[model samples]
Target: MEVAAKPAIRGAASIVRALEAHGVRYVFSIPGVHTLSLYRALDDSAVIQTVLPRHEQGAGYMADGYARVSEGVGVAVTITGPGVTNILTPIAQAFADSSRVFLIATNLERPFLNRLEGNLHELTDQLAVVRPVVKWAYRAMTADELAPAIAEGFRQLWTGRPRPVYLEVPLDLLDEATALAVEPATPPPPSEPAPHLIEHAAQLLRNAKRVLVFAGGGAVSRRVAPLLKEFVEAIGAVVLTSLMGKGALPEDHPQVAGAFGYRWSPDNPVVTLMERSDLTIVIGSGLGVRTTANGTMPLPTPLIHIDIDEHEFGKRYQPDVALAADAAVTLSALLAAVHAGARPREGWTPEEIAPVKHALRTPPDERTARYVPYLEAVRAALPREAIIVNDMTMLCYEGVRFLPVYEPRSYLFPRGFGTLGSSLPTAIGAKLARPDVPVVSLNGDGGFQFTLEELGVLAHYRFPVIVVIFNDSTHTAVKVAMHRAYPGHYRDVDLVNPDYVKLAAAYGLTAVRVASPSELEVTLRHAVEANEPMVIDVPIALERYA
Candidate 1:
């Protein structure tokens, strides 16, 4: 019998094989000249699903959204130069939010890479473009280096501090023949705090009369959320989730102070709780400038900050005890120490927590009051399991402040990067990742214009996402700021918006406008039941959408 011959495989094919080995299910991509070979390999692969987005930015945001919702890392493929530049915003957004997005882009051929000969799609240094944003950036110089580089990228993306990774593959490398069996490498386990540190932190928790646990986006993972719940209950500590950490512990839980509670101001009830607490445990949070109300919020002592990155310990607020460890690992060890033999005393009782939380929830401010009915409609129409992505808009600011998120991964916002026009494509990628879960995209007319063409991608795929446009016909957030600064003076802030209904109709999607909350609830219910793509345009003055 004749010996069997091996199948032909190129460097590009090896990349696909590596992705398959890593168990990546989806890749958001845009086809371009230099990346045709990778696309061809992706087309041949049966396991990986390639999604084409209208713009490179959409592709990156989609990958970010997919990473946020799914258990695995998200992948995006693009060509060199413009493709890389187009994707920087989403990459930065993902980095800011600590989402795991693996960006694979092509570069000029090896010979002409730095020749300054105006090679097609040439960038002097493509890897440099993404270095500040991505956790790691690499340029694979040879066919043999591709698999190892990919393994390292995944290792960085999944372990320690999770963030985006950028890998640049030169065009010439794709021509080399290869048969490397690149099996997936095991990612290192999460880091645990030292025993002495865990015990010392436990002593603080046990001895303190009042304990406050402040969690951020780092605690939102499946491995970490349950530990958080157990830890909070074990110590009877009052829990407050940052906006990015929303839904990490169910908001309905009596222990959860409130979403974004104490994140904004000095006099807020949540901040008062922070002020009075004797011991505060900061988990998976860097306490960045925005989350800490631009550093106006005080750091309560004796503060113990637990984070995967040590550099974050003193960046925004100083900590008395800084534990550099993974949230889940540190939380697990801390819980064990707290539960060792002697039970810890309850920090805040239901009676105490109730009043503070009630204050946080009550007396909706002017901005929040404007969004209540519409938000209630959105909440009433969708199931508890549904996921909602919020854009950076006036409505969304209030939405994140008041939205009751009961499950991990159920709520998403552009928290760190604070980008506008993020929700639509993000929701599309989310719906694609979890088709069983209902998705809604909330945006203001002004921010929605940034990625308006992405609506066409949603229409083409018919992803059954309800897109709600709060049409004020101006950048309400900026306009409000301008009023504060200039008082009775405005310049070029107003906009002429397209008729959203007609625009949706042209995209072959169901379009409706509602003027009342009841109408919005009813129409959204119908749309959900029908499982169809829809656009609900609610004019801001009238506050209606369906």
Candidate 2:
């Protein structure tokens, strides 16, 4: 008997297979007509879970969060035209934060491409829109090119200086049948800094009387943490992690001076450490505007900067010596050199950090005391390994100051982009990436409503992410700005919100409304133990925290 012929796999099916082969655990998407073929193909993908968020922007943010926590490529698929445009903000945010996201977007048929024929979901130059935000963008003209494009996108994620990439697949091509084989493209190994560059850094460090190690987000990887700790210990250096680099070294560690907390007046112990030091070693940070206090903080002379991105070497504050290499590798080399012999940094004792730590422990004022209860409740409800996603709000800055994150990738925020409406979806993505750990999102009333529809997704997936919405019925951050600039004239900054308990019920999520801070911990504990998506609406006055 003749064997049955194998059914032909369509291009869309191959794309799914490619993503699976690259070890993507989930694909966040908002399906439309142009993406029907891709969705149909995805239906049979048992290994790859599909998360359908309410909007394209939510999908993109979810993917970004997944990548950040998982340390893997995050995948988001969207339809042509409006879908792509809707997701642009998140893509731009990912680019700014160095998050790796792979975006697969559908486009009109090749014949209709850029013709201005007004075909459904068509753009004059869709690729042009994505190019500015992504590290790379490619358009596949034929069915066979789909898998290759995806492989290249993954390659970009695995390579140096992680960032988002976009791949456009024409609608007609996804429907076509094609035989394709895709090989996983492993990123090239981390490059080594030139021996002379390393030697120069070591020599300068050797002669320095006061040394400070400034760790950035790039130094937050697990492999780098131990080496970084070793380097700091060997040199008797004080550690000050940037906002993005929180938890890179243990905050509780005696050597660490803690993060430069908020963007306010900036008189933290970290700033004190920077001011007193004669030499600063910047590792794996771009020293961006937010991280550097917009260049207002005085950086000491004879700086040594190490970064994976060559462009960042001299961009923010030029260094006396620069080394381009993986943070872990460079830290290891530096530690070795310090052991070989360096000018001993005398009087750099842990006692010096005591006053700074005391200052960090002190609340800014009585207003900040109001948030302590909620933060205390959250800390009690979750383990140290639990992840927190903070939206644009006063609590975010407070969280940065008070929340003790013990592990890398445990705290995420829209720091670089400073966008609202990100915490909810990003929490979902973080939970999806690490299902065993508890993930909680802290969002303000105004920001939470921006992505309210994602409640449906959280309900559907049942990922057990606890969202704490600070409901004061206003855009508190904007209101604060308005109040500062133009007193008693806060127009369009306040909002009238729907009852959150009823809203949560409508989305099939468990809900509890807490009127006082005293009631939060018990309610949070109960909600977290429920093992389902839940919302805790705290009726706190927004002005109290401001």
Candidate 3:
């Protein structure tokens, strides 16, 4: 009988090798005694760069942000107990948005694992706590399992609808020596669309008189985007993007109707186009609360819906023809089936869409004029392709509805979770992922303070990112709600914040304060060209937009 020979290597070393083999370029993490071995193992690697974040939660968000823009798996590592718990918010956010991230967490040594005894960073069931939020969670009880667990995590990331995964390794196992043979991950082949369903979708789209195409976040895939553009042009259809789907087609494209649900007014161009359509074809979007205006926005009947996730097909509104497949694959097939000579559908003409486009792009009224200067400055100073991470603030709500983003993955809004403070960290991650492109985190004072610790991370990495903090001295969203409910009785919403300029200086970053649009343009132009991180503080009146 032949015995299998074991190779001699530390579990931590095996994990690093696995990550490198899988082509991971970055790992966002915090250092701890338990994770020292992992860091030491990382020292010799050239492909993977370990980024140290201020907080475990920020580390998680950095990974989340990276995954969202890069369209690949983002990885994060943390120590036991509190370290694992601190990152729950980001895990939940990834789950909600179906973002792909691999979270590597450490546990107590084998002897103390799950014993409920008083120990540092020990929880009764760490795996259980993370299981609900992640698509799958695995614990490595032995040294040899570490590499396999990582490979499995990557496999999960690539094979299904994008979601987060977790791998928990016991401290003793991480320190133990083991021989493990690991292989690089090969993504599973994309699922092909059914020919019958593809034909039906094409026929329905062709027969419809007034056709409207709805592109969701799921439609942002590289394989599907060009196909969507061609289909829209070939069919002579009007296209509307969900907030998550903003960059699926160029917003300036003549066929585009802009984003839906963000602008609550009836005059929203996308809303108007939707009303005129006799049939709608939804792609990639889940029609979630934000996209559907909390279920109040009206959608047309006789719909043809396509999605990668089968569960989302009829989740909201039943489709006349539901095709469950990847957006890129399905859209490609639909495009191939539609003959170029097919009679063009009778829908929105360029003349009809021009007024709607102009109306949506027009300047706001005097009451909300305070934000206009800053918005205009940002639009002018930043390049058209710059990435915008819109934080959850009063300004963000307006920007989400009205901001014109011209590239795919150019604008990232905290879609389902709607969490505050994710902007700065997420934007930092985006900048790291695409160093050639300019990235900006647009945040209000209240939201900026939530993840203020990340400024240190930026100073350490020295990546050029412009963080524009709107200093309104209050959580304007809450203030407005309170005023509506109890007029003149506003309390606790008024916030006192640190002088943002000084705060940025403390982090070794260039900081400037701007008041008017002209000042902002000058300050922002300088920040964009500078080769380091900078902060620009813009003071605006509280509730000015209300």
Candidate 4:
């Protein structure tokens, strides 16, 4: 008697197997008709945890955040056309910041294409829309190709300049089952820095009287902070981190100058140092517009830029010595070269760095009736080891500038995407990853509203997250900027907010609303000391913060 053969895996099942082989343990998605097959496939997979997001945008942001904190690729599955379109903002952000993510989108059946003049959720070209925002895009044509396509997508997302990759599979292909081998693809090794290039970079640092090291989002890797801290100490170089790179070195460290770019005013000393420095050694930073004052195109200082992505090497600002290498490797090499050349300078003491730090430090009396005293309160309330997640808004600046992050990945934000509604959910993911540390979600009211539904998720899991909401009662950042551009006219911008404290309480979480700066410290302290998810809504005047 012939033995029964193993049941053939088809369509969604095969795709699930491919994902498992890729080591994707968690996937965030919003169910849609086109993706129902894939969704069904995820039903019985014990290895994969499927998180159902309230909105497609939230799904993408969740994946983006998970990828950021995990330092690995994250997956987002969405239906074709409109579902895919809804996630463009997060996709663009992931691309901009070199986030490693895989967006698996299910498209309309190939045979049914153009059957309707303008079908619902039909796009003239979905790939074209996503091309500008992804590292790579593919439309799988066959069942056999699905596994390899996913493997390749994962490979692209992990190699060199890690970024989000989009893959579209037609609904028809989802039903076809065939025996296919899913093989894991190996990502190309990061390019190594040249010996001479390292020597030249070290030479520039040695020759300059006031050398400044500027770190960017690309530098916020597992090994980057320690490497950067060691290098800064060894050379006695003044250090500054971009808004996204805040935690690249410990903020309390004597060498840290401050943050640079938007939210951080151009007049800030960090920007001043960039202007005054004889040499600016930029490491692992893309020097993007947001981080570089929309390319303020600062001084003609000699520059040595090092990053893993070659496209980012001299794209924004040309570098005198551009080395395309892994951040950790380049930093290590530079540290060795710097150690051989010079001893720590006596003049570069902690006291010497104090004046700049003091100038940049938020003043105790800076609080106004309208703006919440975020920096002062957070500085006082949060523990030294708390993991902070900052949403995309003015709050990001305050959080990074004020919060003391001792290591890389300690702080999370959408520097590249600048996407709102990420703070709370990202905090949940971070808390799950690092349960020992206290996690705080720092967000503006507008940003918080984007994924406020996640409060239910937080409540269900009983994740202890201290959510600090800057309740400005409107999108103050945009409204103020609009007023600057068009003084008299009111476009539909200001939003009336709900009672966030009540909303939090409805979800079985503790909540408080602080109306004055005086009340901020006590409220924040109480929230931090709580055991369950809590929201501290601080009513603020947006105008003052602006």
Per-residue lDDT of model 1, residues 1-546, tens digit only: 996766657998889989899988889998988988888888899999888889999999999999998856889998989999999999999999889999999989888886679677777777787799999999999887888789888998878788999899999887778766696879887787888987778777767878888888888878888899998888888888888888788887988887754248766777778877888888888888778876677656888998888888888777878899988888888877877832345578877888888877764566457677888888889888898999998767776656778778888899888898999999988888789988999999988999988888878888898899999898887777778888777778789999999999999989999888788899889888988889999887632221
Candidate 1 lDDT? 0.84
Residue 525 of model 4, lDDT score: 72
Lowest lDDT block of 10, candidate 1: 537-546
TM-score of each: 0.95, 0.95, 0.96, 0.90
TM-score of 4: 0.90
Task: Please write out the lDDT profile of model 4 over residues 1-546, one tens digit for every residue.
Answer: 997765667778889999998888888887877887888899868899887767777777778777877788878898988889888887787777777879989877887553555656778777778889998999888887899999889888767888899998888899897677789888777668999998888777767777778888788888677888888787777888777786787788888867643454456655555555677788877777656666674733788898887777666788999999988888888888876974333325567677878766644345321233556677677677677888876656555555557767777777765777878877776776677877888888888888898887777668788888887777867877787888866576678889988898898888888876567777767766765778888876646423
Clashing residue pairs found in predicted model 3: 7-179
Off by over 4 Å in 2: 1-8, 264-266, 542-546
- Single out the weakest 10-residue window by summed lDDT for candidate 2: 262-271
lDDT of each candidate versus the true structure: 0.84, 0.84, 0.83, 0.77
Considering TM-score, which of the candidate structures 2 and 4 is the better prediction for this target?
2
Cα lDDT of model 3 by residue, 249-302, tens digit: 888899886775464555555677777887888998787655675656678878
